[model samples]
Structure formats: structure tokens, C-alpha cells
Target: MEALGQAITSWVLEGHIVEVPGLGNIRAEVRAKAKSDASDVSADDIFRHHLLLTPTKEIKNALNSTPINITCFDKDGNEVNRD
Candidate 1:
């Protein structure tokens, strides 16, 4: 799992789109900073990175049709019940 995560991160950092089998394509987008009159900040400092996920049709259909049970976990790895 760690290796897979690393691979995905590397791909996104390199400006490449990663396509998962049945899920979607993950890509990284750089958002430019807005111009402000009061603050003068460098473009590098204000630039932000964002991850965009485009889900596949199959995954979208599944999400719409299926009742997904999302398991929530805490920092200590304890399962948090939502019900």
C-alpha cells in the first residue's frame, strides 16, 4: 500500500495523470495566486497545488447505485462508528 501511494504521489508531482483501473484518473493542477493590492507576495509563495480526480463512469454508477459503508478511523486506528 505504501509503495502504491508513493507511486501515485510521484506521478502527480511529475505532472502526470494516473489512471486507476476502475476508479479514475488523478492529476495535479497548479493554481495561480490572485492579484492583491495590499499584499505583495512572490508567485512561488502564493502558488498552490491541487489534486483533481476524474472518476470513471463505472465508479460513478456504482457510487450512485450502491450503498457504500465508509469506515472511519481515528488517529489511534480505532474505528469510529457513524451509525
Candidate 2:
């Protein structure tokens, strides 16, 4: 498990997308502010760097098919509503 995690991290850090079986493709992403002048742009313009995941169809389908149950309680711990 550790080795697999290391490999994923390494690939993403190297600007490559790593695909996980039955899950999705993960890649590194950055959000930067746009500058009118190309020369004005720099690494400082990048405010955030994160991972982006594009889930597979199978994973999306499984999530969509799953059911969610919600229950609400009153301040006194009495059941108010159930869904």
C-alpha cells in the first residue's frame, strides 16, 4: 500500500495523471490568477495547487445508485423527522 501511494504521488508531482483501477484518474492541478501582460505572470500568481480527480463511469454509477437516509432530531433529543 505504501509503495502504491508513493508511486501515485510521484507521478502526480511529475505532471502525469495516475489512473486507479475501479476509481478514477488523479492529477496535479494549479489555480492561478490571470495577468494581462504575459511578462507579469509568475509563480507567485499561483494561489493554490491541488489534486484533481476524474472519476470513472463505474464509480459514478455506483455512487448514483446508492441510497441515503436522513433523520432529524429535536433539541430535546426527540425524533422530529425521518427521510
Candidate 3:
């Protein structure tokens, strides 16, 4: 996750968003979408960027140790035989 954090920081500092290769989007925005015409804005008013990553089936299947087995149920609620 260090890489993700670093990428977000760099993007925010550079005043632009960065989409990591094979990863999620990271962008910065003002907190609560303050109005442009409003006054008394603080310098610390900045929204932190976030990073998201979608995992592949390899990771998901590995996490689920239990192998999947297809099954069917009959009208009486009994599991029908595959054969």
C-alpha cells in the first residue's frame, strides 16, 4: 500500500490526478466542495486522494480456500444427484 499512498501524494502535490497502471484512480478535491465565491478559505482545506484496485480472480479464488461445487435442488428441497 505504500506505493498507492505515494502515488496519491504525488498526484495531489502536482495538482493533478494520477491513474496507476493496472490500478484504480487517485485524485484530490476540496473538502465538501466549497463554493468559489465563498471567502475565509483555509490553506489546509484540501481533500485527500484515494486509490482503488480491483482484484483478479486469482486473488479471489485463492482467498476462498473452499472449492466451489455446483448443486441443484428438487421440488421437495432435496439435493438432486448430478449424474
Output the number of the TM-score-best candidate. Answer: 2
lDDT-wise, the better of 1 and 2 is: 2
The residue-by-residue lDDT of candidate 2 on 1-83, one tens digit each, is 99999999999999999999988999999999999999999999999999999999988999899998899999999999999
Best by lDDT: 2
Summing lDDT over every window of 10 consecutive residues in candidate 3, give the lowest-scoring window: 47-56
In candidate 3, which residue pairs clash?
Answer: none
lDDT of 1: 0.85
Per-candidate total of colliding backbone pairs = 0, 0, 0
Summing lDDT over every window of 10 consecutive residues in candidate 1, give the lowest-scoring window. Answer: 37-46
- Model 2: clashing residue pairs? none
Query: Which runs in model 1 stand beyond 4 Å of their true positions?
Result: 33-47, 66-83
Off by over 4 Å in 2: 74-78
Residue-level lDDT of model 1, residues 1-83, one tens digit each, is: 89989999998998899998888999998777666764765667556778999999988888799876778889999998753
The per-residue C-alpha lDDT of model 2 at residue 40 equals: 100
